[model samples]
Target: MITGEIKSQIDRIWDVIWSGGMSNPLEVVEQLTYLLFIKRLDDQQTTALERATLLDEPLVDNPFRLGKDELGRDYDDLRWSRLKNMHPEEAFDVVANRVFPYIREMRGDESTYAQHMKDARLTIPSASLLSRVIDLLDAVPMDNLDTKGDVYEYLLSEISSAGKNGQFRTPRHIIQLMVEMLAPEPGDTIVDPASGTCGFLVAATEYMRAHHADAINSGKWREHFHRQMFHGFDFDNTMLRIGSMNMLLHGVEQPDVRYRDSLAESNTGDADAYSMVLANPPFAGSLDYENTAKDLQRIVKTKKTELLFVALFLRLLKPGGRAAVIVPDGVLFGSSKAHKELRRTLVEDHKLDAVVKLPSGVFKPYAGVSTAILFFTKTNSGGTEKVWFYEVTADGMSLDDKRTPLLSDEKLGALAVLTDEEHGKNNLPDVLKRWQSRNSTEKDRERTDQSFCAPKADIAAQDYDLSLNRYKEIVHEEIEHRSPTEILDELDQLEKEIADGMAELRAMLLGGAE
Candidate 1:
């Protein structure tokens, strides 16, 4: 967790940028990301030097070179530590003229971060503003991996309130829950088709490191972790840049974070390749059939982005590959042919593991679309016996725009020790617990429970409708009412009591008068 002091420091930097004429929040974050990237490069070079000294070996690869570039400017001046100490105007000139060009020309091993720096421009407007921002950034503690990740996440969360292109940052806790449920292994190939800042991929990496540390330390697993384990696709260059930086900061050395429209015909490669996928794809939009991928259309003939993404997932996953993806509630029981067909394909053809219905406000202050997480495995043949359905009412947060945390730190993650009452307020912990035992204990739970298993045959009978409400039996409380004669008797008794009281009052008044 980032301390309050760190968040305040970040906010101060943001204020300086805002007052410096970069009013767009996304632009502000992008510019800040560039500076941070430069700082991180210096830090990496310093660490390399330290390691070389300790081992008494020559440094094979230093991110910085101590020489002049073709423009005859000293490359050493572009280093963050050197630039930070220079006068504001000289520092700005070096960053604008030298550093930006140097980063743009960086190739091969540095291509992941360099690729996005091609169009990098310094728009801070004034030398003093740039200097102030750089100095504040210098004060932030990025030595600890957790602190750096948390600080970047805090910066990303700012974009959520801005609301650009239906993109909202998935709550960190929600991402953690999905990653925990998936339980990605060391060598598992994971992909997020709509990778926004690559939160899903980062969370998966963290989970693996936390649980399978020994496996990650092995040579084979280490090779996979550094290069081949994670893949993400996004069409927006800004998102690509941010996502790639996010991976690098989280210790993923060479994640495939690149630009590709996942739903377009151009995305033909990587079909049936990955072992796991975790995503919260955009929905409620339409696309032209001519532009939609032909392969996805063959699976589900529709232009609705929501349905297309489902088809895209099916096309992307290798046989026996598992996925946990978020979809709008309409995909669950829509009457359209494409909707019904996709749901049927999952239940009849693949292993539809579970459908976790989320609260509508989960995406709030941006959208209130009711959504559900679909857990399934690609079998290319029938494997679904019983589908687990869980209705998540609260996810350790209030179901409102504020989204206040409802649980204490002790009951936060997968290993959360929550009592029944706590589980009632936030059902995520229970959802995971029940999902792990879906085939055993969950199979016998009644339809009236919060989570229960609905047999495949029952689902087929309903035309493969996967909505929890379709099979969930509501246990209406039985009400007892008095009969008409009993009601009349009660009325008569009340009338008699009223008459007796009236007579006693009259008698008392008459006796007093006599």
Candidate 2:
């Protein structure tokens, strides 16, 4: 959804940073995100001042402090609004020596964005580059929420489009499909354990704003939405800052995007805490048994990071809490005991809702590993009867490295209005529609169809292999039949023609001899 104007603005920032010799796209975004956060802080401070005055209260938690700092520069000068117009050297002086430390020492604020800024640094490389980035950032209007989101998304897209660190970028439409399927509610507690750039959290917020405008705008739910609704974990400090800023731009004031190695850390404190989980954790990874979390190890003894993430999701979900997670196809049909046991636990211990097969090309140009989405609810006892399965062959884009869109903006996502022919090119809309019919019509569909349901007993009989290919039936082309009378008439006419030709040849030979 990043348009040309926003794209160009971000592109200009990227160029400035690259010219300064910072080649890592994530770092470029990280530096830009920090400045954007500072600008946002100034705006937030203004709002706080007005509200405190209106309530006849003293301003207490301003991002800027009173009077002078250790360097004798006024604390006000450290703000983006004031320092942005200063001379390049002075601006760099404040940002490098003053602003960076100010944010780094911003430890008292309980907001999640502040939590991640504890180790923040200003790595914009040079004063001129910093100023150019600021001018570019200031020119693009962030006043509109939609434009703000578009800008952040474009900044993140540059990381993927750069072709080096694209593993961090999930296809935007895929994130939308997951969000739409989850349908976030006002009070729902959401978490993404491996939240690279927090795309899932951003999408969930957009969906909530679009679908539940009345409730989301109300004061009670609004407080929950801003303060406590979303959480994300990432070990990389740079990613944590970028992801938190992404949520902030999308209007969530304080998302819990903090530092934690999801697989290495214990889930004891957060066990059964969240109401819903949405994630696509890093996969095809192995961990030492000693390094893995004990609680997760207890879920199903394994070193596979993918399986451990699934265990973490199970522990994170409150009873009756649901999750929709993307996993490598190996998780579906791995022959390992851990894999079989995990699939069994989902079907027998809780409720396994669906397994959606994605095309192998879905993650192309970064990773070609085949993946699938698993939907389940955390129940103490078994509730799964029939588990739905869907195969998404195309996601409105070329299934290659280019990943070019095959449809216009309006015809791209899960809610797109696409015809049958168009649906062949993009299966997301159909996936969404058929997901709703999983219990009813999907159950009646033949295995040869794109989607169908399988009974729990059937799954157990096959050792709980959830791969769609295991259950999907291939459609065979029907054969054309011929009648015996038509075949016999053609054969008889062919025999008579052969006899007449033979007689003429024999007569000609005898005449020639005479």
Candidate 3:
């Protein structure tokens, strides 16, 4: 967790940047990404230097050397460590003129973060503001993985709360809930096609580090975790930079985060490549069929971005590879042939694991559209026996524009430790627990409960409509009905009282007139 003081510092920097004429939140984050990445690189090199000296070994590489560049500034001055100690004007000059340009060349031709950084430009307006930000950022420690990653994550959350760029961020708690449900293994190769900010991929790295620490600690798995495990695609250049920085801060050395228009890009070379996919693609929108990928169209012909993304997932996943993705509610029960065919494919050809309904307010302040998480495995032959269903009412936060937390921080998210009473405020913890037991106890649960299973045959009977209400049995409150005789008697009494009151009123009026 990032401390309150750290959050304040970040917010202050953001306000400074916002007032500095960098109005776009995404642009602010991108600018911040450049500086943070530079700082992180210097910090890593410093750690390596200390370790090597302590072990009496030669330095592997020196990112900076004492030499003058063509611009006549010492190469060392471009580093965060050196720039932090310089005068404000000097620091600003170095950052704007040299440091920003130098970062693109830090990593070789093949580095994703570097590839994204090729377009880096310093948008911080003034010397004093940049200095103030550096001073404030310097105060916050970024030594440990958690603190460093949390710092960036907090900044992203602020961007979300700031409104314009909230569309780029998924609520971290919701991301955590989805990650906990998937429980990514160390060996899993995960991808998020519409990878804005790469929240799912970052959460998966955290999950692997937490649950499969032993396997990941091994050199082979560590290499895989760093290089091959996490992949993300996005067409927006700003998002690619932000997502790369996000993964890098989270300790993923080299994630496959690059530019790709997921829906439009052909997947012929990468078909059936990934073992896991997790995403929350754009919702309730359509794309032009002319630009849509032919292969995705072959899966299920649709222009809806939501349905096309699902088809993209199906195309990308290797046989038996699993996925957990968010789709709008329309995809759940839409009567269109494309929607029905995709649902049928999941039920008839592949294994549809579960459908978890998220609250409409989950994406609020940006979108209030209802959405649900679809968990399924790609199998050529049908294997879906019964699909688990969960109705998530409260996600520990209010279902409103503000999305205020209803409970303390500890009582939130899927891994939250909450009492039974607290569970009502946050269903994610219960959702995770029930999901773990989905094959066993979850199947036998009654339809009226919050979560249960629907047999494959039953789903087929409903034309593959996967809406929760289609299978969910509402336990309406029982009310006692009045007998017909009693009702008529009450009506007669009312009529007699009306007549008596009217007669009394008429007599009083007549006496007054007389």
Candidate 1: tens digits of C-alpha lDDT, residues 236-283: 787788788777767776788888889988778889999998999886
Using TM-score as the measure, what is the rank order of every candidate, best first? 3, 1, 2
Candidate 1: residue pairs that collide: none
Cα TM-score per model: 0.86, 0.80, 0.86
What is the C-alpha local distance difference test score of each model?
Answer: 0.83, 0.82, 0.82
Off by over 4 Å in 3: 1-15, 39-85, 136-167, 265-267, 494-514
Instruction: Kindly give the number of clashing pairs for every candidate.
Output: 0, 0, 0
Off by over 4 Å in 1: 1-11, 40-86, 101-112, 138-164, 214-218, 408-410, 419-421, 495-514
Any residue pairs clashing in model 2, and if so which?
none
Model 2, position 289, has a per-residue lDDT of: 88
* Tens digit of per-residue lDDT, candidate 3, span 1-514: 3445666777787787777777776667666667777787688668768888899997764555546987686776777888899999999998987877776766666899889988788878899888887877777666543343444555555465434322435777888988898888877899998887788898898889889887877756988998999999988787788788778777787899998988874645688999999998877557788889898888889888889989999999999899999888999999999999999999999999999999999876566788899999999899999999999998988888767778877777789889888988999989999999988898899999999999999999999999999999998899999999999999999999999999999999999999
What does the lDDT read for residue 413 in candidate 2? Answer: 82
**Candidate 3, clashing residue pairs?**
none
| Cα lDDT tens digits for candidate 2, 1-514 | 4544666777787777788889976666667777887887787778778988999898855767878966686888877788778998889888888788777666447777778877688877788888888888887666643343344445554454433322445677888898898888888999998887788898899899999877777757988887789999988776777787777667776788888887775546888899999998887657898888898888899988889999999999999899999998999999999999999999999999999999988776567888999999999799999899998988888878667678986788899999889999999999999997777778899988889999899999999999888888897899987899989998999998999999999999999999
Quality of model 1 by C-alpha lDDT: 0.83
